[model samples]
Target chain A: MESSQNQFSEWLNKQIHSSNSGAFALSPELRATSLSVLDAGVFPNRKNEEWRYTPLREILSQSPVLADKTQINPALIAAFKEAVPNALHLVFVDGEFSNEFSGSISALDKTGLTIEHISTLHGESRKRAEDTIRQSSLSDDNIFQHISLGLSRSGLFIEIQKNHEVDRIVHILHLSTKSESRNFSNPVHVVRVSENSHMQLLEQYASIDAGKALSVPAVYIEVADGAGLDHFKIGLESNQSDHVSNTVVQVASSGVYKSHQYLLGSRLTRANLEVIFSGAGAQASLRGIYLGNADQHLDIRTFMDHAFPHCSSDQHFRGIMNDQSRGVFNGMVLVRRDAQKTDALQSNKNLLLSREARVDTKPQLEIYADDVKCAHGATVGELDKDALFYLQSRGIEKAEAKLMLTRAFAAEITQEIEIETLRSYVQDRISNLLDGVHASNV
Target chain B: MLSIKNLQVSVEDKPILRGLNLEVNPGEIHAIMGPNGSGKSTLAHVLAGREGYRIDGGSAYYKGINLLELAPEIRAREGMFLAFQYPIEIPGVNNTSFLKKALNEIRKHRGEEELDAIDFLDLIKKQMKLVEMKEDLLKRPVNQGFSGGEKKRNEILQMAVLNPLLAILDETDSGLDIDALRIVAGGVNKLRTKDNAFVVITHYQRLLDYIVPDFVHVLSNGQIIKSGNKDLALELEERGYDWLLDKAETRD
Candidate 1:
């Protein structure tokens, strides 16, 4: 395992040194930080309690080449256009932004909203981007973040001006095309919602074909005082793909931050979400749904930190595993000594559809302050036998009954989505996936 | 329309119904009254083909078909309806959609055309009136957060819509208030036809006064000890089950 880590480090170093100079150049500070992290060799293994359920041995052993700039297929573009026609889409192929496939954003630009690529920033704008990244980088122990910073320079930088509300949704589509052997791509994104502004953003990761690839993405968001942001991250990659993502959010006083994540496909996927309440009276709601089948392994870890007084945070995550799939959920809530009147709650529920399916859930609440309300719960069980019988006794066949119960379980989360089109889109995708499973069973 | 001979059932190796026997012809309502733990619910569940029960012996025939040989869903499609004593609450399954699906499945089995959305709405609206159910309850989840009376009324509403050939009401009037009981009984009476039968299982005879059963039977230790007209229900209600148990023990 040590040898494999060394090989990965050496290969990453070589890629950084041999790549084109200007496009992938990193600032001195970021370079130093990345190098120090690489030298620490803190790559997660089964020994790490945070990564005990999901092992990265297979991903680390493979020497994945850095994906080259490739034109996305027109057919794939057409498919996305049909999926979300009204939204403004920004397409990223092989980790680089595509101009031809993106929608026109002139209407949004006139209203003081800036949506541009990070690599295109110059002068003070570039410095501001770097500063945002520096402030949001809470930890340097994450190897994936280091990799994303050191080698990949393609990402989005979105900023909403004060007192402006962006009604249109901004969708960032990350598409990976087929390549020889397994390839790797990393894209970083930064979003800053100014004071008294509101915005909605969606980041979707997908692949064009059934190709072997590994994607590591990083997202940083800051909700300023009295601002609100609704964010969604969707994972719909191929079955042969492996993905790891990190999302960090900071909410100021009186600001509201809401996030919904849907992880529906991939061979092995891991998502780490961290939200920090840095100011009093800030609120955050985090919800996610993950579905796994066959031999897939899915993991979700969340950290909700309450550093100020009179803050509240709630998180609810649900998982459905079938076949030989495995799911893991770890949620931790921390309240500081000065953070009184803090309200935090976390719940994780999992349903195993098959005998071989397994789930591991852990909920931790660490409170150092008095007069705070904190509670958490975790449950793992099979589908309710009585509910199934009720449906069956109503004349529904066994298979159809199972499907209805599964849909009902998922509706608890999907119904929370405020956007109607997106909710229906997700519902359609889930229905298709379950239909495929039924067909295979038959 | 239904006949059972010496039906014996055990749950978890413990016998609940030792030797229950009954016969019901079309166009008749048979009220089976018993004390608590006398196998009233066990008989209803076994007839509905619920699993987890070991059918020790005996047979049940519905319309000359072996009812025990069918799956729970098949039995339902074949016109067997069981109004649960404790209705299960499904959190996310909408009441209207659940009823629509069940109605369509039964229709498909009976060689009838399935109702479209508009027609289904029309039909359900009429049936909902029979049970005095609110229109909003149809939009909510099935039995979720419903009151005891509301759940019982929902069961009768389902029965009215399905119009089954054989309906088994297991303590349908247990938790209902006087008004709810009257509405539920009225709904059941409206659905009763000359070609269908109903088996009302209850511990009290108050429900029989509204539905007016054609026959009443006393179930003691999983066997019918006496069978007579509706006055028999009045006698049992007046004297309770102790007198009947004493008479059966004396005879044995």
Candidate 2:
């Protein structure tokens, strides 16, 4: 299985670098790079620094599910419809787009953002798409990008025109149900927030048993002077899949970027979040809450760079690990030489309920300039025994007290989410997860 | 309804309470007055069943039940209360809710009906006035951010609400001003009853001047060297525990 996955990764890298038809064409160089990374990914010891805590060796041991060429997953689709019925939904089944399960295609143009699929990018409109891909770095160093550019044609893309804000949310649903599939998928969202424009994006990932799902989903946000964007990623993937999700966010002069992630499921799910403060006075907030249980291995690596002066960034993430599950939170904050007075703070706190449950948190700060207010800290432990006794002494049953305190710990991060409905929904999900584990100290 | 027979306690292989015997019938107020390090507070803690205090060679009886065998909460539910000299400061649990839990625990154990929220609030309001504690403090976390006098008053409120048969006030008068001390003493004084007893563990005779113990026992070096009436405390106050200690040492 290891050697097979290696070959597939190598093939993927070759395909990515293969310079092809047009500007939208998959270059050989991109494919070769992805292939090499996946090839090297064969050894559990060689998984990238981001995958250090959550082992991918077990994930690679499973045979890859052949790609599905059929219908979208009804169960996966039903999950979202039950929760977010009003939002527009685009279906991607086994790394292939499905127009049959989609809703309201006209809403994209009407909402002032251009939406397109990767599979059908071979016509006159392909000229515009090709120009953008080559100019942008979405395909850089990513294997999913190579295959997504090569064989896939139905990926989703959204572009917000200059100086306009969308009032509705864009939901991209990835539903897969079959196995042994060549799994190279990319869900790209190009959001151009013109000067003073605003936009909010909701990205959801879900699937059924199939080849390990590699999502090179890239969200390119160009916030012009004075504009703002709020991006939320909700990962409710199937229980039997491996996923790698990348989000590249760029902020311009005086812009604001608020990003949030919720890692709910998947055998092995790793998220690479890169946010750059490209302009002076720009601000960003990256908040995440990962709840893991059983054999789940989830890692979220956040790289935030303060490239200009007077930019501010805050990253506060916490995790709850139960049973034999493992969780990792790696946060890096960098202040460039010229980024003076760049106020930045990062904190990662975790709660391990079971003896086997574990969390490895590393918070790093690299400040090139002095006179900056930058502080980073990480804590991994169970609930306070004294605090627990205090609650138990109050007649609160042991079980109920654990749940309340556990919820209270995560409340600090989830409360700051900009979307009211999203916040409440995530809170409910967290409560249910705690209730299931029976370790959530209320 | 509390009795102690030959209660001796030690820490780090050294005795603190050596062969001390005392008993307080219901409706009576007894004071244990001594200088610093008299093991006055240790006696209160041992009675309350705090962790890590070696009983050495004695047994305490509360309501005819072996008090030492029960855990702190179980003892608490069985009508045994201790007003700690230093009440614990819990940062998140609210004071009102904490007292309510204690009340219900004892009530439930005694086969009595539990107080509902409204009844509980009413009960708390009545007891708060005894210690002059404002409603705001009850709303805050247990003993957290409370002044020293306020913490002492909170302990009394717990005593009043729990209504334990044996209420041991350990150094209750240590950090209070005149006004605060009176409020605290008044609170304890109101709870005096034929079915409940008060053990006022104090350092000076001044608090006894207000609470007015029926019996004063001087504890020095793990032993009760002197036991007398209210006049004994006045004499010790005028002289000091050191003078009494010196007299006892020379005789030994």
Candidate 3:
């Protein structure tokens, strides 16, 4: 494990040295911080509680080659961007931001929203992005976050001004063009919604054809007092692709932060999301569905910190595994000593469609404060037998009945998506995924 | 239209239906009454092709085709319907869409063109009135959170929509009040015709008063021990099933 870890670190060093003139070079201070963390030579393994249930061997065994410029299918991009019909599009192909496909941020100059590429930002803008990155509450041992900070060559810095209600959503599409080698991308996105503001973001990661690549994108979000931010992340990479992402979010007084994730693709995916309430009367609602097929392995970890009083957090995640796929959901809700009147709820349910398919869900609640309400529950089972027989008795074929019940299980989560087009797009993708799953009554 | 000859079934190596037999022609309603634990539900379930039942012997033929060989859905598509005694509450499945899908599948099996959304809605609305079912219940999940009466009414509504050749009501009046029973039986009466038949299974004779049966049979120990006309139900209602059981035992 250590030797494999060294291989990854060595590869990271090579990436930093080879991309001499790449876009979005890390600042000297950021580079030094990342180097110090990497110098510790402490990479997560199965021994690490946070990394348990997820094997890093697949990602660490192979080296990533620098992606070469290639022609991407215009129709593919056109079809993928249809998920969000009316939104500010930000296209990132092979790790670099595509100016041709992206919308003009200049049009939003008077709308009190500042959207800038990390490489183009200078002086105060750069400093603000860096400041937010420094203030991220992610633990120092998260080497992946630091790796993205130090070696990222493509990212964006978005800020919504105080009291501004941004009507348009920021739709970021990470399109991995087909590559001959196993390429890698780690784009760091930093977003700050100022006081009393509201914003929505749709971040999607997908690949062209069955591209073999690794994406370790890191995101930092800050929702100020009275602000609201709806962040949705969808991992729809190809079956040959692998993804690992880190999201750190902080919400201030009376702020609202809602996160919805759909992990429907990729051979292996590990998503770590941490939300910390920094002030009183704040709320956080987290919802996600991880649907896997074949040999896919999807893992989701969430950490909700109720450090302030009068704050509430609720998380509901569902998993559906088919073939030999496996799913893992590990969530922890913490109420600190002074965090009184805190309400937190966490639930995780899983459905195994095949005998080989499996799921491991652990929901943890640690309450140090009195006068708090916290509840958690977890369930893992196959589709309801009675329900299946019921549909079959109604003349729906067994395969179609299984699909309906599976789709309905997912719709329960996708219905929370406020955007009609996006919700439909996600639901359609789920249906397509379920369609390909062999109806084996194992 | 339906024939059962010495049908034998077992559950987990324990015999539930020793040798149940019955026969009914088109346009006739046969009411099967029995005391509890008389294999009433088992016969209904076995006929509907539910799993976990071992068919030890005997044969059930519908239109001269062996009913035991087909899957539950195939049996359903072949114009066989079973209104469950305990309707399964399926969350996330819309009642209207479920019925529509059932109807379309059966139509497809019959080489008939499927109904579009508009036509289906029209047909469903017209049939919904037969059972006095609320329009909102059509939009909700199938039988989820429905009152006992509503579930029974939904079953009748489904029967009305499907128009099966042989409809078996397995204790449809079990949990219904008198008014609900009337509405449900009324729905069945409206859908009756010369081309289809009904098998009304119940524990009490009250339901027979509304949906009068041409034949009444007493099922005991998984076999029809006694068969009589509709008046037999009233006699059983007055004397209870013990008298029939005693007479059958004396004959054995």
Candidate 4:
């Protein structure tokens, strides 16, 4: 395991130095920092507390070529856009932004919103993107994030002007396709919501049916004072795909950040999300659901930093594991001494449907302030027998009954999604996944 | 049309229903009045095919078939319903959809065409009026956050929608106020027909006041001690069960 981990790290480092991908076109200093970090990167092992439940054997055993000039079916892209029909679509095929499939970027001039591809950004927009990326400090900084930073080929930089409210949702779609060699893509997206402005964004990662790819993406978000951002993500990659993402967000005073994530695909996924309270009185509400079947593995780790006073954060996540699948949730809420009167709540509940299915949930709270209020809870259990019998007693078959209870368990979290269509899409995807899972598995 | 003869049941090797015998014909409503620990709920659960009860010595025949051999859902699809005393709360399962699915399953079992969405909504809307259930309750999760009376009413509403042949009311009136009891009994009365039967198990005779039973049986210590007409319920309500127990003891 150690030798393979080291080989994976060395391979990725060589790729970073050799590849000339201008997608995320980072500044010379930041690029150098990423390479240096990658230089010293010994890939995380099982002994690493954060990577204890997750194994990188599948990812480390592969050698993927940087994807370029891949052919995609237009109908497939059109169908994927239906997930968010009314949004401004930015489509990416194998990490490169597709101008033909995406909505016209020049048409958003009247909306006080600037959406530009990283490779095309010139003066100020380029500097703003670099500055945002430089300002983000990831508490769980690892080799993967630097791999995305040093090797990204394409991504977007979105900035909402101060006091402007964008009604339309901005949809960022990353579509992976099958290639001769295993394809690899890392896209770094940066979003900035200015003061008094509001916007909604949907970042979706999917693949052509059964297409094999490796995706490493990084996202940096900034919510200025008095601003609001509703961010949603749905990962529906293929069963042969592997995805790892690092997202860092900073919220200013009086700002609000609401994030909803539905992870329902991928052979293996590790999603790390960190939020820092850069100013006081900021509030963040996060909700997510991950459903895994077969041999798939899904892991979610969240870090909430209460650096200032009077900031509150609430997080709720649920997982449904079936067959031999596995799920992991590790969330930490830290309240600093200066963060007096901070309120934080964290909860992670999981359901294992098969005898071999498993889950590991850890919810931690570290409060240094005496005047703070914090609560954290974690629960892992099977479906309630009483609920199942109740449904069965009403004449529903046992299979249908189990499906109902499982769907309801997920609905508790998915119902919090503000977008109706996206919610339905996510719910349908979940139902489809569960439908393939036989009732006897429960 | 249900028959239980010498039905002996036990829970975890501790006997609960010892030689309990009862018979019900079509169009008749039999009220079985018993004390708290007299195995009334056990009888209801066993008949409804709930798990965990060992049938030590019994023969429960429903429509000439051994009832205990079928699963709970099979029994339900075969026109049996149990209005639970303490209805289970199923969060996230919508009330309307649950009822619709149950009704459709039963309909399919009966070789009838399944009701479409519009038809189901129409049927449920009319049946909701029988229990005086609020329309909004149909959209909420099943029995979740419902008050005691509301939960009882929801059970009755489910009964009305499913329209079972052999319905068992397991202390349905226990948690209801007088008005709610009346509404629930009224719904039961409206659903009764010459082709169906009911076994109303209760701890009090008050519910019999609204839906007068054709027969009243006093159950003590897992067996029926006395059987008579409706006047027997009034007698038990007035004189209590001590005298009846003493009589049964002396007779034994």
A430 in model 1: Cα distance from truth in Å? 1.5
Error of 2 at A333 (Å): 1.3
DockQ of all models, two decimals each: 0.84, 0.18, 0.70, 0.80
Give lDDT: candidate 4, residue A276.
92
> Which residue ranges in model 4 land beyond 4 Å of their true spot?
A19-24, A106-108, A439-442, B247-252
Clashing pairs in 3: none
Tens-digit lDDT track for model 3 on A341-415?
A: 999999999999888999999999999998999999999988887888878777888888888899888888898
What ordering of candidates by lDDT runs from best to worst? 4, 3, 1, 2
lDDT for each candidate structure: 0.85, 0.73, 0.89, 0.89
RMSD (Å) per prediction = 1.8, 5.6, 2.0, 1.8
Worst 10-residue lDDT window, candidate 3 chain B: B88-97
The residue-by-residue lDDT of candidate 3 on B1-252, one tens digit each, is 789999999999999898888989999999999999999999888888889999999999999999999999998899999998989888777888888998999899989999999999999999999999899999888999899999999888888888899999999999799999999999999999999999999999999989999999999988899999999999998999998899989998
What value does the interface RMSD of model 1 take?
Answer: 0.6
Q: How good is model 3 by TM-score?
A: 0.96
Candidate 2 deviant stretches above 4 angstroms: A1-50, A66-155, A159-186, A192-194, A197-202, A205-216, A236-239, A397-403, A418-421, A439-442, B1-57, B60-241, B244-252
Instruction: Locate the minimum summed-lDDT window of 10 residues in model 1 chain A.
Output: A103-112
In model 2 chain A, which range of ten residues has the least summed lDDT? A22-31
Candidate 3 wrongly placed segments (more than 4 Å)? A1-5, A16-26, A439-442
In candidate 2 the C-alpha lDDT for residue A270 amounts to 80
Between prediction 2 and prediction 4, the one with superior lDDT is 4
